[model samples]
Target: MSSISIRKAVLSDLETLLELEQGVIKAERPLDPFLGKGELNYYNIPEMISNKNTHLLVAIVNNEVVASGYVRVENSKIYHKNVKHGYIGFMFVKENFRGQRISNLILDSLKNWAKENSLKELRLDVYSNNTGAIKAYERFGFTKSLVNMRTEI
Candidate 1:
């Protein structure tokens, strides 16, 4: 494993981020009912990286983004206790980059950012079927605090 540098994403990294997002969507298609057939909007990359309340982190290998994750501050009535909390989302590590501890580094970067922003808690929602991701979060000290159900209309 080469040295993987994790950094905050900028507008210049949009294209690479979009590619990463698409890769994750494709990988999850078999297990995720919400992921349908379509390409992700590459134009939204700028917004995703620059959103004032969001933190986008990327792991770069040889100047290319191979892994990415995001943290957003949202006000929630229940899980957040009506206060601002950090929510992790859009986490992805390129297939070839797995087992290198890159995801853990990205997560640590996000957690550091959350702490710097004075967030009291961090939360995330993983698909019930994504046991791998659930286990990863569990290893990071995340507990099952809530159960969510969905109804397809």
Candidate 2:
């Protein structure tokens, strides 16, 4: 841990973010093996970078990116009580950088971003089998909010 810093992600960081995303997808695929391998750019980075309602953050050590995450303001369906919420996603930290509080920095950054956007609640979807991530999220004060179940027909 040599002076880790969390900063807003910029368009110039596109390549680095994509590289980290590759590692994240590979690491998480086992949790959702049914999905197999596929591209996962559900939220466009460039668009998010330019969107005022989204905050993309990166953790860096000595100016080199070691981890990243983002929180975006989302609108719920008309039927939901919570109309607006912060959706955290695309979190990743390099293997060598684990246990260094990098995720905390990312989460703190997102918390501030969410508050600034006047969001009262935050939500994220995780693969049920990703116990490590579940524990990590729990350490950050997040608890199980919902569950989705399915089976092959």
Query: Among these predicted structures, which one has the highest lDDT?
Result: 2
Which stretches of candidate 1 lie above 4 Å from their native place? 40-43, 78-82
Q: Against the unseen true structure, what C-alpha lDDT does each candidate score?
A: 0.83, 0.87
Tens digits of lDDT, candidate 1, 22-121: 8877766787676556765423668877788889999999887899988899886865364788999888998888888888898899999899998988
Model 1: lowest-lDDT 10 consecutive positions: 34-43
For each candidate, give its TM-score against the true structure.
0.89, 0.91
Residue pairs with clashing backbones, model 1: none
